[model samples]
Target: MSIADRVRVHSVETLSDNHYTLRRATFDFRRNDGRWQRQVRESFDRGDAAAILLFDPDRRTVVLVRQFRFPAFSNGHDALLLEVPAGMLDAAAPAARIRTEVEEETGFRVSGVEPVFQAFSSPGAVTERVHCFVGRYRPADRHGPGGGHAAEGEDIEVLEPSIEDALAMLRDGGIRDSKTIMLLQHAALHLFPGAVATPGK
Candidate 1:
């Protein structure tokens, strides 16, 4: 379609009773060939969120975390999962949230955070827009691998795997988290290609 102008829309929540978001709408638009067209988009009620896929350039590695993902387990995954350093936005800007996530999850003081892309985690029923980014780290920063494991039910283990090793893990089905996979793919294409080396540390 050439363009679409949103008309009036409304929502009715049933399943959630109070939390399910909905959008019913009509659009005013035209097709490329001059025919009128309409676009209907549905959305859920959710605030913004952020996810950070961390890479240690100086060590040529990316920090990965493993945790008990109840949802995935109930969905039939054997183990919980392999995932990137990620978290909710909490009303913080994507960049700021990412930096905080890196520190809290990996103990790598966020040095340089580069906006990678924004992703829609799911479109079927969730209104989650993931702001993805990359944070650079070095050997000096790995004084320890830190993360959260509080009563809120967060138990995490941080890992710094070589870029080559990380790729191998990706190929072997180890890096399965959707967001983590995307981050690794980005690093493979842009950060590490023929060789892997730490840059600063």
Candidate 2:
């Protein structure tokens, strides 16, 4: 039987609903050997998000952002994180949202974003599926000093580092954010083409 035929959802209980929604789910599943099992799981429903890596191929440089992340600090990580420009979809299309976010977060307006992939950030506990992209940019694209919106309490620092240096940061533990790392690695593989070696050998 297909997965849909083998599983059933019982009920969902909302635990919170402030910035995002949290819910506990109850379900029943059929085992491969024909036994049925029941299960309950809790998940966060912050909605999907989009992220983009902006690169200047002519100059071999990339644009990134640094912002204070309270969650990271609470979890024993350095609060300031360097990452690609990103934001929650909040009902906007992934490509459209990322284009706006790139400008709002990095001061760089980018066009012609190429979609890379979509991934779940924390599948076991969070229902956030991130849409990823890579886009081309140039120095002329800077139209403002983008530090995010003051109304949203965003104080961001834009960073432009050479592509090589970014890869080095990935290797040396300077860049620790997951989406940032994924996008940079994509740039190294497709944009730079054979510049980065595989991790083990």
Candidate 3:
């Protein structure tokens, strides 16, 4: 049996010379109630991927970034956030893409990056898939605490804390990125027996 959602291509409009707007035709997926519902969603219609950087089993620490987030601010809190190295996978190779994001976002060289998993970031509203991985980080070898300026208005801070400390933050509700949380908790349980979980940054 195949478990693929039925999708219909309703209409397509050109967003720009380089991009397109996909207006998907509405056909309500029948629920168990057997009622026909209709809904419409607009897809940006771009072929893009996402990237995540996992600082390897550093003697005991993970490299993270603290930055200003507009979303959290609008909701109720300040705009600053602690997050793992991450960005869109705009490159050819996912691992290499994440490695580059790590260095650019946090100024760390992620050596032996291993692909752990790939999953949907927001399947309901967006078609964004995140390539999650563990990148080996070396402090002495990596050049500096690195960051960049973007048109998107981003300010990032680099941080390195022991895994134990990161775990404490997780338990205390400091970490937030869902993908990073899943990766770090897995690492704490399997990579370091006694090490605690903590970083979303």
Name the top TM-score candidate: 2
Model 3 C-alpha lDDT per residue in residues 64-91, reported as the tens digit of each score: 6788877677887664677777776654
- lDDT of candidate model 3 versus the reference: 0.66
Clashing pairs in 1: 57-199, 58-198, 58-199
Q: How do the residues 100-197 of candidate 1 rate in per-residue lDDT, one tens digit apiece?
A: 77777777786678988988878775678888888777767765556674776887888878888777777777667888888888888887767443
**Candidate 2: misplaced stretches above 4 Å?**
196-201
Candidate 2 lDDT over 1-201, as tens digits, reads 358988899999999999899999999999989998999999999999999999888898889998989898889886588899999998999999998998898888878999999989989999999999999998888998999998998999999888888888789777888999999988998999766633432
Instruction: Name the candidate, 1 or 3, with the larger lDDT value.
Output: 1
Give candidate 2's error at residue 71 in angstroms. Answer: 0.2
Q: Report the Cα RMSD per candidate.
A: 4.9, 2.8, 4.0
Candidate 3 structure, TM-score to reference: 0.77
Task: Give the TM-score (vs. native) of candidate 2.
Answer: 0.94
Better of 2 and 3 by TM-score: 2
**Number of clashing residue pairs, candidate 3:** 10
**Lowest lDDT block of 10, candidate 2:** 192-201
